[model samples]
Structure formats: C-alpha cells, structure tokens
Target: MASIAEVKAQIEQAKQSSQQAMRAVQMLNNQLDQAIQQITAASQGTQHPKVQQSLVALQQAKQKASEVQASIAGGVRSATEYAAQL
Candidate 1:
C-alpha cells in the first residue's frame, strides 16, 4: 500500500504525461492546419473534389484533436483535485 504522498506523486506523474500527450496532439493539429492551408493555396481557386475532401478530413481531425486535448485537461484537473484531497 502506497502512502498518500506516493499516490499523489503517481497521480501527478500521470497528469504530466497526459499533458505532454496533449501537447503533441496540439502540435499535430497545427501541422494539419498548415497542410490544409498549403493545399488550399496550391489549388489556386479550383474546386477539386479530392482536395475538398482532404480539407474536410483535416478539419475533422483538428476538431477531434481539440476534443482529445480538452479531455486530457479535464483528467489532469481531476487528478489535481484528488491530490489536493490527499
């Protein structure tokens, strides 16, 4: 059985790891945005079906990434609250 302090430390570590993963997801989302922009620019006012689909896919991915980040943040907040109680 772990002491309160040890359990708190473990929770904190998990929180940090989750935060790091959130950051990485954010970075990937940024890159996806860049790709979308580049594709739009390359299209130069042409309505390409494939390009439109690609853009939509990227946008969806960004939205999902944002949700993931929010979820992770919530988890971290919960962990912090639990640690405070400890």
Candidate 2:
C-alpha cells in the first residue's frame, strides 16, 4: 500500500497532468477558432477548400472540447478529493 504522502504526490501529479491536457485542448481549440475566423473573412462567398476544411475543424473541435474539459475537471476533482481524504 502506498503511504499517504505518496498518494498525495500522485494526486498532485494527476492534477498537473490534467492541467497540461486542458492547456493543450485550449490551444488546439484556439487554433481551430482562428482558422474558422480567417477562412470566413477571406472566403468571399465562394466554396473555398480552406473554408470547408476550417468549418469541419470548427465542428469537430466544438464536439470534442466540451467532453475534454469535463473529463479533465472530473479527473482533477476526484484526485484532489481522494488525496484530501487520505
């Protein structure tokens, strides 16, 4: 069995990992947003390939970002609570 100190350390590590993952997701989402904005601005009402790709990226990111954030939050919360109880 792990000691309380070890468990607390692991919890901290898990929290850090979650934070890193959240930052990565945020960065990717920001990129997607920028791509969409730029594509939309320069599209000029044409069926441009870049605009289509950006729209798909925006859709995919919208679908996944919420799930990613919620999972990160839940994991971090669970780790912290478990450590606190130790």
Best by lDDT: 1
Q: For model 2, how does the per-residue alpha-carbon lDDT over 1-86 read when each residue is reduced to its tens digit?
A: 99889889988988998999999988887877887787788886889786787788787886799789889999898888888888
TM-scores, each model vs. reference: 0.95, 0.82
RMSD of each: 0.7, 2.1
Q: Model 1, 1-83: lDDT tens per residue?
A: 99998998899899889989988998998899899999999997889899889989999999999999899999999999989
Q: Which candidate is the best by TM-score?
A: 1
Worst 10 contiguous positions by lDDT, candidate 1: 43-52
Local distance difference test, per candidate? Answer: 0.92, 0.85
Error (Å) of candidate 2 at residue 77 is 0.8
| Residue 85 displacement in candidate 2 (angstroms) | 1.2
Regions of model 2 farther than 4 Å from truth = 47-57
The TM-score of candidate 2 is 0.82
Cα deviation of 36 in candidate 2 (Å)? 0.6
